[model samples]
Target: MIFGNPGITYAATVEVEAESAILVDAETGKILFEKEADLTLPPASMTKMMTEYLVLEAIEEGEISWDTTTQISDYPYSISADPSFSGVGLTQNQDYTVRELYEAMAINSDNATTIALAELIAGSEGAFVKMMNKKAAELGLPDYQFVNSTGLSNSNLGENYPEGTEPNANNLLSARSAALLAYHLVNDYPEALEITSITTTEFDGQQIRNWNWMLPNMPGYLADYGYEGMDGLKTGWTDLAGYCFTGTAERDGQRFISVVMKTNSEEARFQETRKLLDYGFKQFEQKELFPAGYQIEGESEVPVAKGKEGTVEIEAAEDLTTPVKNGQEDMYEVKYNISKEHLDKDGNLTAPIKKGEKIGTVELVYNGEDNYKNLVTGKTQKTAVDLVTTSAVEKSNWFMLMVGGVGNFFSDIFTSAMDMVKGWF
Candidate 1:
């Protein structure tokens, strides 16, 4: 089945306070709302979403496992020891497992642990940077560049910067690209959420908390920003890139992924995200516009040639249900697209047609003044359902065909003679 944009006209009802922002339907990847979504900017630690994705992928491919062990290098050790950067203070001589480091990076935004995981997977941070960019391309991210695994400015790495990158470069992504990346992450590896949803955990005998304040059960003053249904995403901040967040929430079986870049403060990012999510949940609802086996009037049957029946009935193969804006149900119309391959030159199905045979497709078209396009593919994707034959059509007996042929031959001559006589008058 094909999925399309919601029938409601695309409009932003909420005032999102951010440099760039986007809201997407997690199930369909549809852009429900966007503002300057294509403008590329620093993603800061939010860049770790790509790293998290690659790590999950590696574990799935058997190249590594959560139990895989590796030691911290001098570069990461030095970075970890710094109080200014988010880290758990790893020592060079100690061994750490992938699961330990991944939790720190995902839940706490631990920069040093992120570098350790990158090195473990690719043998060097430089090689992991290459992998990140290649995967970004494979994922169809429209605007993105990966300079390092942890989303730190290369200059911050000092002389230890990844071998192939410029000294001062930072990771970059548009709001749309970040949203799409988050969409693929949660959908492709849903297990990742199990780790990301943890609000706090222990590392190296010290308590560390997730940087995403919107998560439930956040400790201390962070609890004021708690949002229901919010879970497992990343947040980022740097002098060059202001506060940014990629947040996901699920309520009433509907999930939405939202991105806000360059907000003024940590609290502001969550505040803006709340606005986006509220607009999504309150403004729309899951609706079944058409039921399975629904037949369209005047276009539900196909003529059958030389068969026992003159025509065969067709209906939708499945239900057409999707997120629809409240109070806009009448803005949708259906269009039938019969398959020419299944018909002869006279637009009739051939004899011996089987039951439930697919013969065409039906699409739902939005009649609203404005229609939204998909974030990945910039086109108005219409929802389509398969059209199938409801019953079988058998070939007529040869004797019956001969009798009909004789009747048609005399009837044609009599009609022609009558027309000629009338013309003489």
Candidate 2:
């Protein structure tokens, strides 16, 4: 798609063959391009990202080890009809190691593998869903609700009722949630990449390939413009949702992710991600515009009361730079919005305020519009306040006294004495 006088958001206009998309800069966590990104669309096997996330988290906590082996319980297996599932065709009694199961899930997008991993780590898929939901909430992906380890619907498994008519614990997730899940997977679980980065693998004398068709294809039949460093991930198809893909790639040190759902065909899903990823990587370049410790040049002076220190120094959090293309830097500028609310009327120490405190934020503007470039990044830096001794306030410290400090302490003593004298009351 082409940019036609786009405004602050620079929102993409391209409608992919997929249902919705969210393309984010992996390194900076910036939304490079999006189409119906917030719209929750069903994610098929990509839901495995959550299953994958839970397994990795367990591994990190030392709750489970790669060498750990587990039983092929019918629980996670019944959710899949595909033979690649780790729990399926389980040699009917063989035990798979924790690491092996994770490999199955991440490298092969094996539904049964995911469930077996979850169960081995957390006792059961039901229990693991607790961990999954808890982790997603912690990561602030409130839009997602995981129902199971595999993306199978409980109702769909009725035909295979290995354990009888009871429903199987299937799973569900949205495209954006899955993208965040992938984001966490790539960034949080470095070990996972060891598997996802692999294009192909074989398990138990069975040759199974990665469902993520991005590798070995050179951005393959997807787009006229291709992305570089495209890695492995998951893909899914069902009668309800056409085809879905969740992919990640990197270029010039800037990593990005693309999530597409409900495409008309498997090829279409791949094509759309290629287009989004290509446009994203080619358009924006990462820049470390500001260092967190950078001390800004100037500060506006304010009134101050008598104190040991005549002036308190306040500095900007960092020097500022932004992500932009060639020749577009100077067109936009940032404005500081620090407020003097923390300062007293006399402009003296207010109980030793800390430096680098959230004194305020800065906003960036372009062409008379809020470029929304403030980035709203999380706490940039910690303030190392130089609490220099300053002269005491000349007037009565009523504020502190009111809070009943030393003065209150004495007043209470006096009051106690008076009450003693009137003890009868």
Candidate 3:
């Protein structure tokens, strides 16, 4: 049933009511879908995923520990006490473990706790934001910017503003870039999901609820909207940002990361995300295009002009497996393009060929246009591999070359006589 020319027929027309949205395969970094995904927009609480990532990185670096405790500063304490802000309420001067703070920040989307974790890692919220930006650069996220550990727009802080804080300050990320962030978070810190996935937990004996309702255990939404295998990431909302969620899910061994930003309501963000995820899961599949060391049965050998054996066998250096939609695996044709550098004007290799030299590329292409009606974009489904010599090929010695020439002359005559005999028969 494998076919090409991917169509959206199997996909339900999902109208995503969001400023930007993107779905990505976390493992392979393949973008499944996107809408206005490059537009810069408020990240909202989804910014906490980066904060959590940095915290986990620090923990892995042995710079911090789950059991390590830090005293609550006035900023975090005041933010926690402010009814307008989301927080795990903390008394001033109270010490809390890194683990508890992480729970508050990730599960509950507590601004104060997020700030605390940021400060603990970077000595100041601003410094931690710098680190966030640095990490974003390292991850190849070109358009992401973080102003604070929490995604709160500065306008929401009211009269309790910090001295040097700017109004309307907030983190920003494109939907595609946000998906990349989530990709790194899950791939690098599988343990962080344990904390982010918690729908309810007690901190200081108070039951805190996670804001991400898409989780299967999120109580009221479980039977309806709760997606199985939906674990973590973060959710966010502000008057300007509306409702945003960066969600990750795993099913049947495949993991997907989805980002929905600036939806009209909390429900729409999750619901639309579910549709996108469904389309991605149904329409695409992972398939191997080529296996390592695979040699074409009848076409394995390339003529070598000066080699001892007069020819050499080649193979692909490695395997290539990518997510292909519309059963492209069967319909897509494999083309091996041998490089001119490996051949002379007569179309035969002039050897002294090294064992592992690059000599060709393999490409996968469909016959017709893709879903977008584009020509399926050449080089999108291609990989250049070293066409290694299975055995080293050296130039023939003078006597060997003379003998080979004589042998080839007789061999050609004998082949002609056999062909004539076959023709008569």
Candidate 4:
């Protein structure tokens, strides 16, 4: 289950044919949907995302400039020269600037251009693979390993490697890890989207077309496959990996990242991702439950035991934004549960509480099922959001409690006398 919803059943209903898939919110890190997302698989050309990330990060750190040019080495040239490989058509000893090479790698899925950039960043493809693995670990990816800067496996390596190096060092990534990689790629360096979105560009005197089929105006595929707001990401295909895509789109202020792996056909990858994007946009919306420092909707102020103030205000530590399904907004409920220890025997908050102190937790629930309903049940329930308060409830003095107690005492005595007179009559 993802985001506390039944993911497998939902994905099947949507006709997602991929072996592994996931859709996530770009900003909130919420998993909207997923199916077999943790299974490891070959990434094919989609591995270039890491290649693009390291290069862009280096540029950001002032370690390298965009205009810095590098000469095409023999290894990279061999890969590009082979007619069987997808490349930017680089010739040996030819020099291309960093930005030019990156554009080719990202938009065209050029293996040779990627290796050249990898070598420039880490001095060798093998060493760059090490960097990729290190960065993967830093990103908290649960399962991932990189054998090469390029996604090519040993059998596909052809004659492109130096002696004594492992040829089978191919890149492996799970759908979860791929989505996380894409998340960091767009969040940390949104500018990369600018390059990935390019439909066509000139490199080495030849026009290169982007491999991502989801973009509009891609010749034969545009009419059936194009989607708006799909500015970024990469596509991959190999005999072992099948068709895989990591796509991101933005509409209004929201952005989503989706990954589909091991689909039946190239077109199927983009089509499946489009279904996920549509589901994300149409079914749910980000709603602000409470603004920062605003009092929780139904919770009462705390009565302090020994403070100068009669009552202390209760408030959320920060803004609460939850993505709820359409037409199910009324089913959204916020519950504030405070521990018994934090309150006196009379159920009033105790004194000596600090501001922002967590006296309780805030829970958000949505009551619905596959077709959507307004009723809350054990089986169909989902938690849309959860937050812990550093100080949701405040401390107050005993004065307010004593005053309330005296009023209740007089009211109870009067009620008893009235009941006795009615019985005698």
lDDT top scorer: 1
- lDDT by residue (93-162, candidate 1, tens digit) is 8889999999999998999999999999999999999999999999999999999999889999999899
Clashing pairs in 3: none
Predicted candidate 2 versus true structure: per-residue lDDT over 1-425, tens digit per residue: 11223233434335566668777666556665566665665676777777777777777788877788877866555554455343334443788787767777777677677767777777766677777778878776736756665665655545442232246444455656677777778888756666787765677777666667776543334333333587757777666656888888876677778888888887788888888777776667766444444333554332334332345554445544445543344444344455567556654445434344455554443442222211113222111222122223233355744554667688899999999989978
- Per-residue alpha-carbon lDDT of candidate 4 for residues 325-410, written as tens digits (9 for 90 to 100): 56555555555667677778777665566666777765555544543221112033333332333343333446766766788899
Tell me the whole-model lDDT of each prediction, alpha carbons only: 0.89, 0.61, 0.78, 0.77
lDDT, candidate 3, residue 155? 69
TM-score of each: 0.91, 0.72, 0.81, 0.77
Relative to the true structure, candidate 4 has a C-alpha RMSD (angstroms) of 7.8
Worst lDDT run of 10 residues, candidate 2, spans: 373-382
- Candidate no. 2 TM-score: 0.72
All candidates: CA RMSD (Å): 3.6, 9.9, 6.7, 7.8
Query: In model 1, what lDDT does residue 124 have?
Result: 96
Total colliding residue pairs, candidate 1: 0
Which has the better TM-score: candidate 1, or candidate 4? 1
Ranking by lDDT: 1, 3, 4, 2
